[model samples]
Target: MKELSKRTAGFTDSVIRRMTRISNKYGAVNLSQGFPDFDPPKEILSRLAEVTKEDFHQYSITWGAQNFREALAAKQSHFMGRKIDPDSEIVVTCGSTEAMMAAMMSVTNPGDKVIVFSPFYENYGADTILSGAEPIYVPLIPPEFSFDTDALEAAFRQNPKAIILCNPSNPCGKVFTYDELKIIADLAEKYDTFVITDEVYEHIVYEPFKHVYFAGLPNMWERTISCSSLSKTYSVTGWRLGYVIAPPVIIDTVKKVHDFLTVGAAAPLQEAAVTGLNFGDDYYANLQKKYSEKRKLFLDGLDTLDIPHTVPQGAYYILLDISEFGYDSDLEFCEVLARDVGVGAVPGSSFFKEPENRYVRVHFAKKNETLNEALNRLADMRKKIAVKK
Candidate 1:
């Protein structure tokens, strides 16, 4: 071959997914990926069964099925505190992955620069590259995962086309607060930059933290593209149902990008997921309660093991600081963890643009039994994987 696609020459298989394979190869409890080990809501499951016989097996409208969009708009409008016109504002995609890609492609040109927070979900890095946008990485300083004001404005000064915001951020689990969102909104308005948000974990927030929708911020509806999924909220990662909600002008372009990219999200899954979108606030409250318990269970185990970790405010992920283990690479530590310690985690370095290598990310989006088993296996870390002096 003369040359493979030069754009992808540097791309590697996703480390999060790679760790899932390693975990399976070693018969370890897989906490490397964020999918729930438990089942989705029974209502959604029941609806899915009914949809099989209802001819939703074929495609719906390429943008989305009418009923699904109406339900989604109602649900989202309630939470976003604004009216959302389903017909003009939404473009359903194969998943938030495609939703984000469509948004990026719709907003960016080949030489555009987009701001990406370091230690973001790995896909954002690939999304910017695939969209032909250069990424300007600003660090969300560790510990609290807070960004400095000057650093953010400095990135804005680069005249970027857009910025990717991962609310309840992955790998670091930092939920952006209202004041922080205001700062971002002000800068975005000042710089005339757009914001593309990944909000798959919006409902998985913990106590004392909240997920503020960027589109709901002042004067942001026009410049914000909200990309989210039914994956985390409904625990249906395989369903591949996600969407982009934006102003009609932007949604028009994103709809075109989405149509050429994947046409639409799964018809049957979208129909089934409507049960979840219409679920009352009680469901979300219960979800928070369940995840809060899991977070406590896992964090307490880490504490007993004397491991230092970042206490997340939202999302189900935890970043275990492994510096004391004295490993040269987080990747090596993760390998030994899966092989010898019987647990799996993503090497933290994979998610960072900085030279970071002392952390590994794991998730607790599993059943109590699964989380307990992973925690039990993790108790062996000190005995099994210490570095030699």
Candidate 2:
């Protein structure tokens, strides 16, 4: 048999997912993955039931169903503080996964360089590899998880084809401030680069840390390929509904890449999720309120247990410091955590591109009871760990 392609030689199965499997084997509360353990909105569920019975069982347009795009455009325009053209700017995709992949394929040429933040979502590295582009890593220094302007500018000076921005970030849960976005926008303009954003957690931001759309920045629309999803926003990961909103010139290419990639997001799912896109600001406000409560409950539990953890400003994830646990390998630590402690976490090393082995990620997008259970398990951990040390 012929040898397989060399491009994927460095690839491994997702560490986050591997931890989930370990959680299953150990029967631990699985918090490794970022998915919610609850149902989507009631309105969306009702619409899904209707779509299931209706003629939407058939495929819609290859890009998206027209009404879905229009609804999405209207909703996004209202929030983004700009007019978005439904026909020219939108491409519904299989997920933010596919949306980001399509955006990479749409712009990156082989041998090009793309700037990526360290401790990024795992898929960004793989996306660059798949697109045959080199990744230039910039560190988001820990504690506050703030970026160095000089370091970022240095990466931009490398003349990268694009930069992947995951605002309301994963693992560390850092939301980029407007000043930070402005610096990046200025650098993108200076270097003539594209900005491929994964803003899936846009609506899940906590108080005092707002989410600002990269495309909405002054003079950025033409170069920003904004990728987002209804998955986190609506608690419907299985539906795989995501989209790219960009300038007509860039989106034209994205539409083609997305067309051949998955041929569009699910037809019935898209039709159903239109209900969520049409949700007013009050719905989003309540979403923040709900997630904020989860964050408080989980963090308060950790504090009571005297565990060290990063306080997240946005998104549903928390990074707990494990340096004092005396574990050298985050991978082994996570497995031990799952098997012995009865709580699952993704190794922080899996997300960080740097030599990081001192932390692990856990999420709280679960019901109150589930969060309580995970916290209970975690409280048991402190007892076992303190005795060992």
Q: State TM-scores per candidate.
A: 0.99, 0.98
Number of the top candidate by lDDT?
1
> What's model 1's TM-score?
0.99
What RMSD does each model have against the real structure? 0.8, 1.2
Expressed as tens digits, the lDDT of each residue in 1-389 for candidate 2 is 99998899999999988988999999999999989889999999999888878898777999899999999999999988999999999999999999999999999999999999998999999999999999999999989999999999999999999999999898789999999999999999999999999899999888788999999899999899999989999999988998999989988999899988887678999889889889999999999999999999999999998989999988889999988878878898888899998999999999888899889999999999999999888887856554224
How many clashes in each candidate?
Answer: 0, 0
Native RMSD of candidate 2 (Å): 1.2
Error of 2 at 376 (Å): 0.9
lDDT of 1 by residue, 279-314 (tens): 999999999999999999999988998889999999
Q: What is the Cα-based lDDT of residue 187 in candidate 2?
A: 97
Q: How many backbone collisions does model 1 have?
A: 0
* Regions of candidate 1 where Cα sits further than 4 Å from its true position: none
